[model samples]
Target: MTAPITMFGPDFPFAYDDFLSHRAGLGAVPAAAHGTEIAIIGAGIAGIVAGHELMKLGLKPVLFESDRIGGRLRSEPFKDGAGAYAELGAMRFPPSSRALFHYFDKVGIETIGFPNPLAPDTPSTVIELGGVKHYARTKDDLPKRFAEVERAWAEALEEGAHYGELTAAIRARDVATIKRLWHHLVESLDEESFSGFIANSKAFRELGFRAREMFGQVGFGTGGWDTDFPNSILEILRVVATGADDEHRLVVGGVEQLPRRLWALVPEVMAHWPSGTSLASLHNHVPKPGVAKIAPGTTKKFAITDRYGTTTEYDAVIVTCQVWLLSARIDCSESLFHHDLWMAMERTHYMQSSKTFVMVDRPFWRDVDPATGEHALSMTLSDRLTRGTYLLDNGEDKPGVICLSYTWSDDALKWLALPLDDRVRLMLHSLRQIYPTLDIAQHIIGAPITVSWESDPNFMGAFKANLPGHYRYQRRLFSHFVQDDLPEPHRGIFLAGDDISWTAGWAEGAVTTALNAVAGIIRHLGGTAHPENPDPIDRWSDLAPVRLVE
Candidate 1:
């Protein structure tokens, strides 16, 4: 049997899963540094994971949040009290996220197959484009033109990126082969956009214009690559190469539970802290107020000021929030980071995302329509304004939720100015075009919930999507965790979160990067990782992302 492909990095192939599962634990700090306080800015999965690990290493992790915790793993609950909720932020997670699953297992969170378009368990799928609607249970049910686009995509990957060999190497954890193949691709394709890659590929060229449009509208794995067309081809390839876009599962209640649970979990085995101690107990079950300012203090410490005008100094700081907030919302000192690092943070392009969800009486979509002998509604992928619609079935007896519209980038921007009622009406209008007989509004139980990440002051955008020629910028950010090559003034602060990872927008990236921050902190405060369970920094020399010449 072929080894399962995981998010083991075509960029940095360190095994974070192994490190987390190891019995030796993530090393310890010196006796003097044991009780050192480390400020973690942001209460998202990244911040929480970093704090949890840091706490285990006999360090005090102070978490600061501007808004609600869990960041993008937002699970907004309905008043019905039946455990139904709208996943306003991250909804699906791929199984390749081994490191993230470690926390899920630790927290006792369960997962079920996500209702992605064309997924096996998804009752059915509706692919509508250019005023044409095609209902399909699988790819074979779609017209031959879609098959051509699918074939074109496969051929394009194999031809342009050596997809087969690279994926094989990734599955086997053959770091040498992965680095060799990926480095060459990055050097050659870093400047190419996803659309440019498809347009220039021989397979796509043969298929012509409409085929390319189809591929963009209803992409492989998840759905729709049109919004991502402007991003670097390397970004798309990383998703495909590492199986980051395949076999996705939804967390059983909501993904937010992962971070929340981690915050409250008390490890049975810990270093300095007692067995019963937890992050919540340490902070009195509440995080500090939002950060107002961050500046360098005496003796290489960081001075953090909260919104309530309280100031405190810490030995080190881990910033897990969106890097854009550094300039947008916070008063940060210029001397804290190098100019090149600032340039990288500024250049990091974030994609806007909007999701509008409504709770229905039950899984009404499963009802059969007499006239057509088909289900009333299905998981939808479309070119219309309501780009993708998903049906979240809780159970036959419980209320079901429908993500009326889930859009990214331009589509999300279109909904940014619209009010909740207007947004719902517009999305329902678009869905009406697809399902004329389905009375969706009649089944809606409660008020709809919606969010546009770009509109929120706390999160400027949903997640990072590297633009063409952004490899250098991303390299600078991802490598900041290993600060050996950095200047004295910039040495202590570490940048983490999915945005700082090569594979952004995935929870695995968030968890792995948080682990990176943990390792960085351990080393910075006079600690070392166990030789048997070497952390990311320990293996940085051999597996660091390839840096391109300017």
Candidate 2:
């Protein structure tokens, strides 16, 4: 009934709204299969969503979660309790994420413009690089030199990548035009790193190293993308062209609310259960054990063994966990997937992220400075160990949250071995250097919370960020959700996650990919996509990812 929810991002102009808007039915779950159980692995957003939707189509979905339900969209409340919390993962979300926004709107989770480092909503930003402190509320407030660097970067996109042409084609959903524009980019930029793109681009070449270095220190849109400098240019271009790195917002409670709510959201239809069927009702109130192994069955249909060595069989299985788990954690049979697909899963590199949060008595940073008379310091970017510092304002009455340090890559690795106290001390020392006169320590009301996703056994890294020359690898993984091409044994098992999405690191990608997996599972089980809202394969040639070679 409503307009289709599509991401106009040139990388993959997937119409998620089309899939959701299917009014009649998702396809044929044979009369015999109606009540048959489908095994859904990893109770993260992708798995929860796929399970939720499949249940509506008269299939019984048994969701198995190894850890928490939310996955990388982690929102940890203060030790005192819930509400004022630190987002160890996925804090800010972009407005352009229509698929993700759809569910948020469905559940009535309110969102407010996030005050990201240099974005328009942030009251002020302090760029501390090379010991010099520069302050601004916007790009206009930034120094002329830095402004020119930003301009040069924008200009380079227009000329070098045909940014305007590609963006327009993507927004128009002109698949032919998108393929024409993107294929060239895939060929030209796949092997080239982000740093390489800057060096080769006409504008950056003209501007020289200083401009490139400046761009690295305080990046365009999101904070320093320098850690991503070695990744493919196509990756950055997609984020920039889609406007995903701009016009951001954060959930009032936490971004994780979207998935967590979906976990408990009652399905409209129930196959074997009563009227109001939720994920919890499908399983007993007790939590399920972690998955230890998955393999094609001799007669059990599909075999799944839990950590406790309990095994179960299902007609189909959907794996929504990080790909690395298949290799390092799960004892899956080599025969389960093609070698190339397995290689892609193993090669899917996930970037490390570190976040430290402390509760302050109030929004103390909003106060005036004694010496210079500026709001003490709102958001900070620095060359120090604390690469980016964000201030979260809960309320004037309630305690505010200070994300003392948020760093990625090697910068994150620095705090890995340190205890919470030592990490907090290092962050405080780094902050004191930027705000020399402020006694920021005095306002602290609670112990700091910290996380290194890289150190976590369950999650190898925060989210996926494809490397240069890895487009081929991603294309294989992205296409795996489409079951028609798979061998018979692989047909019943589906792969779905943000990692398997083109626009990795965003919730919309996870939702879109999850929905694709849902469609795949339907077709695999002899169901058809609704006529009005066809499956992705129905529009594959035009919308499929650009193959670099062969």
lDDT agreement with native, every candidate: 0.92, 0.82
| lDDT for each residue of candidate 1 in 438-524, tens digit (9 for 90 to 100) | 789999888899999999999999999999999999999999999988888887899999999998999889888899999899889
TM-score of every candidate:
0.99, 0.96
Give all candidate RMSDs, comma-separated: 0.9, 2.2
lDDT of 1 at 158: 97
In terms of lDDT, model 1 sits at 0.92
lDDT, candidate 1, residue 172? 96
- Per-residue lDDT tens digits for candidate 2, residues 1-550, read 4222136646666667656665664555666668778888888788878878887777878877788878888888888833688888887888778778878887788999898977767778899889999888777777898878888888888877998787777667777788788888888888889898888888888889978988887887778878889888888887887778887898898878877787777866555557887766777643467799998776656889999999988778888888899889999888889998998998888989899999998988778766765789769989899999999888788899999999998899999999999999999999999988788899998788999999988888988888898999999998887767677777778889888988888887888888878888787778777677667766676577776664
Highest lDDT scorer: 1
Clashes of 2: 2
Q: After superposition, how far is residue 339 of candidate 2 from its true place, in Å?
A: 0.5
| Highest TM-score scorer | 1
User: How good is model 2 by TM-score?
Assistant: 0.96
